[model samples]
Target chain A: MIGRQSILEADVDTTGINSLRNGPDDNGRFGIFGGRFVAETLMPLILDLEAHYRAAQKDPAFKAELNDLSVHYAGRPSPLYFAERLTKHLGGAQVWFKREELNHTGSHKINNCLGQILLAKRMGKTRVIAETGAGQHGVATATVCAKFELPCTIFMGATDVERQMPNVLRMKMLGAEVRPVTAGAGTLKDAMNEALRDWVTNVDSTYYLIGTAAGPHPYPEMVRDFQSVIGSEIKSQFAEAQGKLPDAVVACVGGGSNAIGTFHAFLDDADVKLYGAEAGGHGVDVENGHAASMTGGRPGVLHGNRTYLLQDKDGQILEGHSISAGLDYPGVGPEHAFLHDSKRVTYAPITDDEALEAFQLCTRLEGIIPALESAHGLAQLMKVAPTMGKDQSIVLCLSGRGDKDVESVGKYLGLL
Target chain B: MTTRIDTRFAALKAEGRPALVTYVMAGDPDLATGQAILEALPQAGADIIELGMPFSDPMADGVAIQLAGQRSLAAGQTLRGVLGMVEDFRRKDETTPIVLMGYYNPVYSFGVEAFVKAAKAAGADGLIIVDLPPEEDEELCLPAMAAGLNFIRLTTPTTDDKRLPAVLKNSSGFVYYVSMTGVTGAVIKSRGAVGEAVDRIKSHTNLPVAVGFGIKTAEDAAEIGKHADGIVVGSVLVDAVARSLKDGKATDQTVGAVRDLVAEIFSGVKRARG
Candidate 1:
């Protein structure tokens, strides 16, 4: 078991966002690593976003509307609770949980989906297309598009469609078309492929609501910027709670949206520790199940931008496995690539067994069941919290509630 | 004659006609048929031959080329296998320059040093990695040059003056000017823009510049040939192979279609030269 004392004693710096704003394209892509790599058909739409996002950041009307929505609809200022019981039980450092679960849709995914859907409306796009695994992103997309009266198509892998039937139905009820993509491995990556094909076929009328901070240029940067609210909120929330930022910020990385969102605000904060928890299925071996791209992959181009990927000797993409459907992808976001290369963040992996153990522990101790994807981050709390004294603080982003994962957990526990 | 690519441009300039380049995916339909198409290209008025090494995912390519890649991969075509084809061709013909074209991952997987050495040893005169640009030169360009193999650079409409010089610096054999702003197999109605793009690139480098991406028909090739040093057609030929397969006569149809396009393009080049 990992200790928590080390996490609290870690330093917290908050200068990453300031540097990002000052960098190229007002986001941090050094060169070929970052740019908008959308098709020519969507160039005008993205350009509109480039203009609106710049304006919205400065516009009081936009800020006020977003603030109002966050407060009333999505439940703004999510609590920062000290995990005293967890810390004491683990016999380690102090731990604090940044409760993103309290948000309306019960996950950090809503933060991005809601923001992008609104941007889509502003851009005069009436239809939205999204890809999902575990149906978290699809549900979120369906939820937001419903609220906005925008038509949506959610592409889910046939495998995920079978596993996440409840969320699939929820998306259907929310009035979004649930497209079960049967190609490839019938997983998140396949869903993304189908979504891209749809976007290419319907580029004129549909807005591709990319679920994470991955894909080609502009998307990784754009999605990160939209999701950066998590980091920005955490900075002030942690400050108010502990009279300073937490020593470390830890979040799970699937396609890395949630991690990047939570990590971006602290990039330049040289003192603050940043940890990206990757899905370690069984182990790090190629054939062994794991989505530890940063740990196991080489620098290669995939999707749009050059990033790490699980590929064979011939550079053919290898299937990635993880208990969490969301984290079972071979490639990671490009910014994570930049961060890994620049040594700005530490990327590590948590095994499926470890995450499941953490999932059960958190549910038993706190009466809060976390999505398996978010459990990866909670698992890190056990690893990092035990090394420091009680004075140091560790903040773990609880990205989603686990209600959607009850059936899977039941089966895993042999209670189904 | 000078060893520099510019000297080849000078030679083509005295002829006062554009070079007619032909592109065919290696192992498309089957290895034997793809090889046969390659061998027959020079006789069909092809000045430079661009042979594609298939990849599973070709982001820059259209459906026609993508299908060709699928067929090639299904036939178990490897980079080594394609290089072997080049060796076989070199035994009989060596005057016409052969450029191996494909995505970067295969080469990266093959190990840059090993791939460069193998390509040079196999009698491959040049390489055209569609996805690799100046940004990724460290991966293959430097090693390829060290092995005495030409690294052809692709300059798209997006390649501005600011970025052109870097593209030209690392480039060898020739510069492949993508005629359109989209993927391969797209058709452009106007050649005026392509001519202007060729002129823009000419102002930057004196290398033999071949224009491709949307050159579908002979007229399109001829129009582009007026401005470019070489007119390259890809999708039209791949489409021919696809048509052949659909017709259940891929062997005869693919070769015959390529022959027809080559004759038309050659006639255009001859008219320009005269």
Candidate 2:
């Protein structure tokens, strides 16, 4: 068992003063995994963002303000509930849910959005830009932008806009102008390309509120730091409930914000295992299946950071497909790539069928409708929990609510 | 021996006129048509040629070039296929400088050493890798230079004085000044801004500064040529090829149309000072 410590305060300390998750050394390299591989035009802007983030890291007021927002505004310290039915149904490990879905935006994406928006405000930026896949991050960014009264623009894949209609409406309702990117395969990568282009064009006045723990430096690190509250709270909540750290932590990885948030605190804890579930649309058959970057992809550069990417033999990025739009990105967080290489985290692929079944199982057994993205972890839970010792426990980072996925899931299951 | 890029720039400098560097995606409609356009570029008055190596994901390009790349890829264009076009172009006329321009992934996939050797053997003169920044010079820039290929660097408006040295440190052949902050095909906002940025780059380095990314017409070329060492028109030419296409196949207008635009641009550039 790991030492009993105040989970939330211990690691969320941005000072990196005493944290086990030390990474992205000086040049944004996570053991040759993460590096700034962007166009030269964005370099100066990125450097400016890094300098501001570094300064904010040292500022006590910045941390205090962010902490306050996390608690009072964003409704942090999200509950870690013991899923009694899930544990009994699995007949293996005791399954616990880190209720990030219960957060303000009904997802974990709000954590990073809040942090980055605050940074944008702090940087004197009046406008904000973001990219979204399933539009969770777009909704979160639009929410924060509305609150701050900042002009916001969101770049979403045209295909995603057609599928994630509710989110598109929500962003518009929140006063954000959503731009549909029709480039490439008309997915998350294309949205990111448009967002980057917008940033390069309006770098002086606009702040790119990247939704995931990906992108160029400061972004991967900044988003991870903001979202680390999930892991920090998990550390404390799991200890409060089970009297010690859980045996393992599982979360779905798209750009891996939620997974990183839940896994950041447990990186140094050798006893606890970190299992990240990548979207396995059909079964990771690279030709037509999923977005399992580590499983099917090679190390390559995309969107700024060099990480595990779904690309062709000639380095051209391939569009990844998944039933879950949020989990369909071809590139994963750079830190996840680093952890995969270091063997600190074991990544597994969970297919669409498996996730669909898990979604139904949890909805009926526990009366909880999980996001398709989060269902990936629950799918993994069903696979590994039964084989594990009954004495062990697993904490699934329930990253998002399922309301956004009902329509898509219905279509997938032939219920629509 | 000075590379073709350097030779062309020196020749232009001697003639007291700015150079006209024309860019076209290889195998846009088809390889045969692309080769025909390539062979016709120099005679139509292109001082140097920047042949685009098409990749599926070209992050730096705008709509025109992206479509061109997509069309080339759809037509089954590969790294070998683009290089083959260059080699085919080299069979007869060899005076016009040839520079292969595109993202790094294709060359990286082709194996850098092997790609460089192949590029040099194919009679290619230079490279304009958009994604490989100064920080990543060791990846391809230094190696290409070592192989005697002019690794051209792009200096944008955002490339400030502080970052100019690092951007120019390992740069060779000539400097490409992206007149605007956005991607390729964006309209040049101001000829004065292009002039000022070009002067800024020239002040830092002695290398010729070739301006691109929005010179649309001969008048635009003439205006920019006054301030730049070379005038580059990519998107318009790519759009020209796109417009001249008949049912996705290059029509007779493809080569003639490109030559017509280049002829106008070449004349406009010569009128800068000469």
Candidate 3:
């Protein structure tokens, strides 16, 4: 068992990224995952972004404006609710839920989109482009862009477009163009490729809003910084509520934005346990189910930076399966890679069956309906909570509400 | 007929100079221009030519290389088309080694045995599939080697001592040491770190060590060449071809840029060796 003390002392930079506005060049990536991965034709635009992002981060007005919007519009300082019923049922650890579900468009994704769209407006970029799976990000991006009166284009997997029709319609209602990408397995990965192509084509006057904390360089770091609000809030709230940090911090990992965001402020805290729950679809078979890249994958370079991915012997990306649409990704954020390798955090997988059971338990016991993606974290709490005493605290990020998943869940239960 | 990669290394060893490998995207702009680029590499001091067999999705490649794949794929460049270009290059220049490089899906789609046989028949000397790590070497590496092809393996900065032996075990061609921890085309301020990495790999294997990924300028090549047996320049060469196509003339201008870059790096290598 590698101790947290040894993990914290490792050479890798665990300092939360300093600013939000800096682009690819500034942080050596985009949002921690984005970098200059395109042709020279796009370099000028990327450089322009780097310069503008740096300026915006330093400008007090931009910071105040973003902060104000987070509070007033998007609703900042989302509550950390103690799940008394759940804790009583578990008979061990006292579990608390960070309600990101109560945010404007729902989910922790709004944190990144709000920050990036603000940066985009400051950069004088009139159009925003985004890629999404399950449509949570697309809906969030479209809603923000609509609020700002910026033209928005969203690239979604054709399969996702069909499955998550409500999100696609929501984007359209927001006057955003939803481009269905039909290439390469028609999933989140393909949507990303198409979005990247769009960004290259429309680099000028366009800001690409990456959804998750994954991609290349700056994106992973940048998105983590933006989403770090979750962690910062958790730290303060936990201190106020319990007089000490929770014993464990748990969140679902898709591209790992929510997990990374929620885990960032606690990385330096040696005593706090951090867990990232990956989607373990039906089973452990790579082809059949799950987006448990960290648990099931090898370290390989994908999208940009080296991260865990569901790839074959030859590096061809396998189409990852998950019951939750948001968790159906093959790769994860690079910072998560750094964290996993350094043993700063424990990454485990929750099977779809387990997540479903957890979802039902949360709804029936706590009277809270969670997004299928967020249910994975609740599933982890179920596993880990029973071992610890009732006094021990656990913080789980309830990423989004289950309203969007009602139809899917009903169909799964054979009630629709 | 059977020229071992070791024989080439031994011959180069007597000369006391590092080999210069140039990578070009096949059918970039067009197939004719790709052939011209291939024809021009050796004259420009490129001892080895790595022809990128463009695929629909190249996961390891950055934007420049990804676009190059897109362009090649758009121009209807297939594995067969790339092999034809290799065949054409072999007609005029037989001394320079030509390695087919790309992802494995296209090759797998083409049937491994048939692809190996066809690649050998088409005059390709080596294979460097970016995705094919040493852990799963039996899939294509063994079959390719069985068909008289040299299977080149890439060792990254993260590949520790425990993994090096297995990586070098069946590796017949020169080992490609990725210069950094990240993806390809990332810039490095200096090759000092890469030179150290080269030294570490050299301690493990007798195979020729080629340093690549982020070796942009001639100075970088020269600095890396001091410790490495070869230096591979990829993105910059691809950029040059892309630059040439910006003008209506995709002829000697593209080839000329690559030739000039190669000459600059070759001079640095000479100076370093001397």
- Interface RMSD over true interface Cα atoms for each candidate: 5.1, 1.5, 10.9
Model 1 CA deviation exceeding 4 Å by range: A1-52, A121-127, A178-183, A193-206, A268-271, A286-288, A342-344, A388-392, A411-416, B1-23, B27-37, B40-48, B62-84, B107-274
Report lDDT (CA) for all predictions: 0.77, 0.87, 0.78
TM-score of 3: 0.64
Candidate 2 residues B60-151, lDDT tens each? 78889989998888888889988888888888867788999998777877889999999999999999988888877777898898898999
Angstrom error of the Cα, residue A165, model 1: value is 3.2
Candidate 1 residue B214 Cα shift, in angstroms, is 7.9
Worst 10-residue lDDT window for candidate 2 chain A reads: A1-10
TM-score of candidate 3 restricted to chain B?
A: 0.95
* Candidate topping DockQ: 2
Better of 1 and 3 by TM-score: 1
lDDT of 2 by residue, A149-260 (tens): 9999999999999888889999999999999998876789899988888887786889999989898886888888888889988988878877898998999999999999
lDDT, residue B240, model 3: 78
lDDT of 3 by residue, B226-247 (tens): 8999888889888877777764
Question: Best to worst by lDDT, what's the order?
Answer: 2, 3, 1
Candidate 2 — which residues are off by over 4 angstroms?
Answer: A1-20
